[model samples]
Target chain A: MSEVNNKKLRTKDLIYAGAFGALYIVLMLILVMSSGMVPILYILAPITVGVFCGTVYELCVLKVRKFGPALIMGLLFALVACNGAWYCFVTATACALLAELIIFLGKYKSKFMYLLSFVVFNINMSCPYMIMTFNRDGFMTRARDYYGEEYANGLSKLMTPWIWYALVGFAIIGGILGALIASKLIKKHFTKAGIV
Target chain B: MDFDICVDDSGAILKLDPRTKLVMFLTSSVASLTCYSMENLLIYGIVLCVITILCGKKWLGVKSLLIFLFLIFFRYEIVTSGKGSAAIGGLLTSLITIFLFFFPVFMSLMLITQTTRINQFLAAFDAMHMPNIVVIPIAVMFRFIPTVAQEWDGIRKAMAFRGISLEPWAIIRSPLKTIEYILIPLLFSSISIMEELAAAALARGLDSGNNRTSYETVKFRAVDYLVTFMFIGLAAFFIIGRKGL
Candidate 1:
């Protein structure tokens, strides 16, 4: 019932992915239903989805399956999330992909992947928000256009300095924390948890 | 008969088909957005509240939406004080508009979903040029959230036994570290899960067209026609009303 390394995917493995995709869509509807209150919920959602589902698929498909399939699934999910205006979807997907690559690249046994994945994640965090606000008639343009000179005059009003940097820094660190937790847990219980 | 509010489980609108409820929702939103007159908006507001009561979803969800609109109006006031009375009026109008605008769109969404099964909803989209590639994957993704949440809870408890407090901020300060150490396994699990799902679907004999079964069946009842006509009638009144024509 076990193999050192297998490559051929069982039919059930594909169905598992499909099921997860449907699950993702339904969760998205739930998100829309509760958009305002649960902004941070979805930010952490992709990591869990990627880890559990991708790990299970890899297990069923190949005892020693690499991260390639999971990476592709992530890339697809990101593209769809982007089109769907689920702003953080792409960033989340990128984070997952980067982590997988790092782990596999580091030979799945290095603490270095942990650090590398974290570093890569910081640059990735700014991407989606930038893409979000940089479009025509978008928030950045709107803010600049409507606020005009007052925006540049250092706002004769109160503001949070370093808030933006804090957001990026914290979120990326949060993502790394998530990855670290997964790696540790999976290494310990990958077998008994049936995670392959 | 027209839709009526029922008070059983959670005090929601009952006896309305998904499609009909959806239409009403959209209509409400559009009407709210289209009308700027405070008087008109107030009238529409009453009508919406009544409908919400009728539909039985008199939850905080609807109430919160209105509150959100009010917040916007309040913010607008702070911003529009110098823009004149008309600006104030416009800002309020915009708030009202946004609140109501969701009505028609979400009503249809709620209607279809409420009256029909999930797969049926998927089928409707599928019939309407929704690519399987898109629909199928999205469905899977949607279902993954709860499962992951459950797993995370388990992991948190297990970690707690080893004296690890799963507080998000307490873990580390850098976002990069979190990504590397925590989330990669998530994406990895997602891809791995798919393999099992694909196999399961094959076992179940789900091909392109194998009579996708569903639980809910809906048709245009007499009352449905009546409701549709009522919408048209109201729309007509708006179009032909004073200042409209």
Candidate 2:
């Protein structure tokens, strides 16, 4: 019975990976197509890059069969496409990797991966942001141009609090949506299909 | 299906070298990103539209469809808005501005993807100082994804034969037996492939490359320099201290 269940999980993970990878490619093209016409979609692209990376990583990396890879992949992809900071790329990738390794410790445990995804994305996305406060080559560096020294000096107070809240909100909501939707689908239909 | 947009028949574009295309794309994408205003975006958009159209199969006669979509979308957005004239003008220009951002680089992406074989694409990146870790892993991922996708279809069909429901939620709830049987086999297949891949890449001189060369070298053409300059000018206009975005 254990062997049978393991096979099913492996198959399901592969199928999900291919499905999401195609979805990522299409989403990329569609976003690029719409990027011309829609400004809001611009914001969505950087976030989705990490989500794609995460998806690939989960379906391909974590033997536990988690959705954390997809979330991180989506978020990373978005950041890269947006030409966001170099740190965003490194942090996003590192976060997903760290999350997967941590969740791997739980060893096929339930609901642990979901919490892992949320926590990792929050820490990963926010730390670089705080680090950038002193980063003269950073976005806050550019802030000085628009807001001057007083505004720049107070940037941590000005930006960090708000951005952290926003990052946490997005990661939790997006991570929940990704994991729940994937888990529910896999459990109901794909599991029986021998896709585990 | 190895789904992609229309593949260009002339593989000549591939011969041009991906590094060249990458540079072009970087210039154009950066230029577009730096500017948001109407006048600058128009200048960028016109040049992009022309370049994009030139990249594809002209005889397919997509020109009419392209123009029609461009006009209808732009015109209706501007005309329908109940804003004042300046605002209306701004809206229309905004539409054009958006178009510019999408048009050129997308053309260049399609151009390369259509012409270049996957092996060559990887080889080109390999030629660049791009790290093997990034290139090699991503290549393996793309190659595995399609094979696994096909395997998945087979598993799905097998399930459907047993009258199993395949809806998203339905699949999610299916029991543990299904996972162990179908997915593990595919996972094992993927692992098995890696051994062969390692052997093959090792055998094929993929690793012994202190003296690698290409059939075609990417060099800066006059037109490339011109295009690059134009992009630099536009980007500078947007980024420089005096002018507005």
Candidate 3:
């Protein structure tokens, strides 16, 4: 079983972590920057970001086949991007550490455990957006003052309090979709190519 | 703009020790985030542009300068023009505020990445006696980014050869296919590259347990101190002003 043969992280694993982490950041940055210009894409950003993250997570896990990659990846991304408040690093690290534990607990053999880790890892995708939660009142007030009472009210109505909570749901769906896609690609191309 | 760290030994700014560069980057990033005033942001933005241009990144410097000018222009227009429609005005103002707050920090980050080479940065970290756990991951990360870019370029060329429309519109039209064709190959290639990179790093004794020596000189000179003090002063001024001192 792959579980029995599991080894500790190596220098290569660290490199893989760094590479995949950079990939995740670059992907999200591209999407976020573009979404900023076309605000309509904002709605879809969280889920799609999650999807991209999940894909990277899956690949990282397969290649590294060890623990701590997620944590390092998340931490490096946070430090470089300063993607959010201090809490972002905390949450991202915690999520990745938890994923590492899950992969470890599953003895490195359970596909279910791996997929669960992907879901948790991808949740870090929501860290930047979480900034909105901290300044919700300020955001609303600014919207009201600048946009008009009607527009602000409409925005508030459209953005339910549970929007961030719903983002978690979107994260889960995205994670699943990304994992399924990665799974297919790995099976079809990578496994045969011996890359995996 | 190119975000990767530049290795060219051209600019006076580029000649500063990587440790100094790192300190400057950290200082600017923290200050950019902490200082909320638009005036401070503009000052920080201009200083950042000068540094970027001095570091031989003229194109990025100009691009960043233009962005800063646009932000200033946009704010001026909004403030001077009799209030426009509420939605448009609010949106514009909010965007301006966000841009003001973030652009400096972004520029600072870009400056560090664009000017300091990865090996030099990591060597400086080692010289500073940073924990191996932290240093190793960061070094790996720096190496990883460029490898991914190279692999991505290869994938793009392959797509072009295969008659896949590499345009934004085509990708937008069929994202899933793009992901399937482009990202999948990229991922597979990156997996192998990751392994090779790891092997190369291991061969260089990157994961060694002993104290390591670097040939790169990483000393803080007067300019480093001056830059550091300037940033500290800016932060202090912002905090004092915020406190109504």
Which window of ten consecutive residues has the lowest lDDT sum in model 1 chain B? B1-10
Cα lDDT of model 2 by residue, B1-245, tens digit: 23243344452322344445555555555544444444554565555545444545343225533663575466446545746665445545545434444554454444444444446546777666675434453444344444555565676687788876656466458633443445445444554454455556556555554544555444546765666566667656756622332
In model 3, pairs of residues that clash are: none
List model 2 lDDT by residue over A44-159, tens digit each: 33343233223323333333355343443434343324332455556656665666666656554545564455346434434334334434344544433322344345543545
RMSD of 3: 3.9
Each model's DockQ score? 0.16, 0.10, 0.41
Candidate 3 lDDT at B28 equals 69
Q: Between 2 and 3, whose DockQ is larger?
A: 3
Give the Å error, residue B153, model 1.
9.2
Instruction: List model 3 lDDT by residue over A3-97, tens digit each.
Output: 33657666556777777887877677666655653334564676777655567777777766776777887787667555335776687677778
Give the alpha carbon lDDT tens digit for every residue of A17-101 in model 1.
4444434433333333333122243233333333323323233223334444344345444543343234456665776577567
In candidate 2, stretches whose alpha carbon ends up further than 4 angstroms from where it belongs are A1-22, A28-57, A63-80, A84-94, A97-111, A118-164, A189-196, B1-6, B9-15, B27-29, B53-56, B59-101, B137-237, B241-245
What TM-score does each of the candidates earn?
A: 0.44, 0.54, 0.83
lDDT digits (tens) for residues B205-233 of candidate 3: 88887876776777777877777677668
Candidate 2, residue B186: lDDT: 47
Which prediction has the highest TM-score against the true structure? 3
lDDT score, candidate 3, position B121: 75
State each candidate's chain A TM-score. Answer: 0.49, 0.49, 0.83
**Could you tell me which 10 consecutive residues in candidate 3 chain B have the lowest summed lDDT?**
B1-10
